[model samples]
Target: MGRVRTTNKGLPRGLTIKDGRYYHVTTVAPRKWTPLGRDRSQALLAWAKLEGSEPDPSIKTFEVVSLRYEREVIPTKARRTQSDNLKELERLRAVFGRVMIEAIKPHHVRAYLDKRGQQAKARANREKALLSHIINKAREWGYTDAPNPCQGVKGFKEAGRDRYVSDSEFRAVWEKADQTLRDAMDLALLTGQRPADVLKIQRADLHDGALWIVQNKTGAKRAIEVTGELAALIERINARPRERLSAWLIQDDCGKPLGTFAMRSRFDKARTLAEVDFQFRDIRAKAATDTGDLAHSQKLLGHRNREMTEHYVRARIGERVQPLR
Candidate 1:
């Protein structure tokens, strides 16, 4: 037999087992009245054991946990990764804000995924993955004892893009692009680097006829051997008069580095003007195609694995094959 207590409201206090019913009360507001099912005798014994052990802290609402995660966990990621995660968090907070982290069930996760999948399957998939990370963080923080709700939810399959930019298309876009956009495009095309890494380059990165870069995504170091047009572009970029010398190589109309969003919008405008059906990222694949050497392209792009480099470059089947006659 165990001592049973009551609140001032004539309700069970904490986790109580009496009168063949089990009432599990938690600090999570929406989850205040949780029925841990029948089996009163077993509930009493479990409650007694819990009382004798260390006090378990109550779980917070998803909103509170999300704020904490943004403050703590989000900063640990790379800038581009952080930006994408922040967007996912925004959507998650809208749906799961008041829900108790521990009380989130697989059905709720399935429902959310279903709703988001309607708008964009790819976006929904990203959100699902981000949710798993958030749930894992909640578990790590001791906010939830429940298994991750996102674990069994099926993500919508997305088709892989095989859009490769042609050299003539690159030239068309370059011709139509403004000076600032042209500089960024040329750098990306020449180095076969990600737009984020390209924007991070500074005047100091150039030395001994090579562009030294520490990739922000993979943290891999590379010194791209500069020759021909790339070297000439760097020379012209350096010679351009500046109001104030900025550390960033790709400068905006003002002498500061252009932001990711602004650069993307500018590139979109250039694409429209040129009428080219390709993105800035496609330029990396284009660079890979031009090299005609997989290992050289992999090193140039600073991809630690060949698989990732393969994703960037398209295979030239014609070059590898004799006439199939």
Candidate 2:
């Protein structure tokens, strides 16, 4: 015999009979559940019992929430930011991928911070920040109702970089650098631009002794005037003939754009040869110091505000020391 069909003559407030089945309506999550039978009275009792109650461990695991975050959240960030987040996510997955979202506590965050801080304090701070953002996103997306574990964690004190490359050190690195590294180094020193912007420079970007660049991170457009040695160096790179010409101004032997890792590695090799203890970014400060003009350096570096430009302009020490009369 077929199942008994229940008529909705006196069903209670949270129970409804549709077709031949009775469903218990849930109040908390706005969902319906099957009571497995067609008895309207029993189903109504079940609905009343389950009303105003939370589901058992409705939160997803860390891996599940993180995957969702990677899909929906990470893509919305800038390319450089997205790359950084992915790296942080990789580290997080190894530590907490299998753990439940609600099970994470402040102690776990502190432990991660302590261990990572030992390696690099700045990196630890960044990871902790990223962790806080990810957990908050999880709550917002309904994956978990737990508090963010990283909220109680403290960031490390950052000692910002102030090691500007001196003229002597710059000459040493230049002498030791190969052709490709020399090209990159010259452009960075002349324009006071980031390595990313320097690598993205194309032959077509040059016009009438000036190179127009749109900074990737800040989106600031500036026309950098090339003259003297800078103009001569650019002319040399442009004059190189290729079987299939590349668009990039900074190219490898095969006429292709140099990858960031490759460029850094080559630059590092040159630094080691020269025994210099400064980074490629320090070239910007050196350029700013060489100009002795804040406004001109700010414009060449494409800084929207003078505050950031000031950071790159190092003071010429001992130039104004008062002698004892």
Candidate 3:
């Protein structure tokens, strides 16, 4: 015979059937404890009643939640930048595999954040933010009943970065860069495009007086007017030996599409030769930041919000002269 189940004192309580069977009731979590057997199951049920509530999660909870998130959340709706953060989560699971969620206290998260933040201020800051989002979502998914662990940790404090490429730096880079890289660098500065975006430009994207392309990095479609400077650069490249490449204005010497790392390597070497401290992204930031209107700058940068572009601007050309405590 099975135990008779009932709500005791308005709190769901563990009930023992008239038979040797038992049903453990967890009111808070409201999950069932159904173990198969007669006397043995009943004995376990009795023990559960005496203990009250489910046992704490095991150490493997962290890996479990992370797996669920990557499968269910990260792929479907995450943007490009958000996807980058998810990659970081993949990295964390590799080293700290099988850690329990609750077992991970504030100190553990802080230590991880501190170690990574020291490498790249901007990228680390993004991971810190992404970690918070993931943990909060975990709670909502009923994985953990506690608050987000990242909530208690201090995130990476960012130092201001310089984004402006001085005229001398620009000249030096242009003179020293290889043909493909020089075109890319010119396009990056001219259109204020991200390096990832610049490398994807195809010949077909060029039109009368303008370039038309969808920013692959952000999926933002744009048609920027080709100024005389940009046109001149395109003409210069057109005169070069044609590498039967399928990509737009910029391509590898063999005409293979330039990947992000390759493009960056080229740019870094060029910056070094030019003695410039600025990265390719600083061009976009400086162009957007130095402009008069924040709203216009955001649109040009293909950012959805003013705040996103504003920070880049601030990093490069913000009111640094203003006094702050």
The backbone clash count of each candidate, in order, is 0, 0, 5
**What order do you get sorting by lDDT, best first?**
1, 2, 3
Candidate 2: list runs displaced more than 4 Å: 1-58, 144-147, 207-209, 226-229, 241-244, 315-325
Cα lDDT of candidate 1 equals 0.77
Q: How high is the lDDT of residue 189 in model 3?
A: 71
TM-score of candidate 2 relative to the true fold: 0.72
Which lDDT tens digits does candidate 2 get at residues 236-301?
A: 877766555688999987887888999889889888999998988778777777787778878888
Clashes of 1: 0
* Candidate 1 positional error at 272, Å: 1.8
In model 3, where do residues sit more than 4 Å from their true spots? 1-60, 77-83, 94-96, 114-126, 207-209, 216-219, 289-296, 303-311, 314-325
lDDT: worst 10-residue window of model 2: 2-11
- Rank by TM-score, descending? 1, 2, 3
Give the winner by lDDT. 1
TM-score of each: 0.76, 0.72, 0.66
> Candidate 3's residue-wise lDDT over 1-325, tens digit each?
5444342211123534435454554445667665434433234434445666443434336656665555456655425654575567756665454576656666777788778777876676676676677678767867667767777676666666765766677778778788887777777776777777777788888887688867766678778887778788888877788657555667766767877788788878887877777777776765675566788777677888877776777766556575685
The candidate that achieves the highest TM-score relative to the unseen native structure? 1
Worst 10-residue lDDT window, candidate 3: 4-13
User: Which digits, one per residue and each the tens of the lDDT, describe model 1 over residues 49-114?
Assistant: 544642233547787676566656776778778778867877887798768888888898889889
lDDT of each: 0.77, 0.76, 0.66
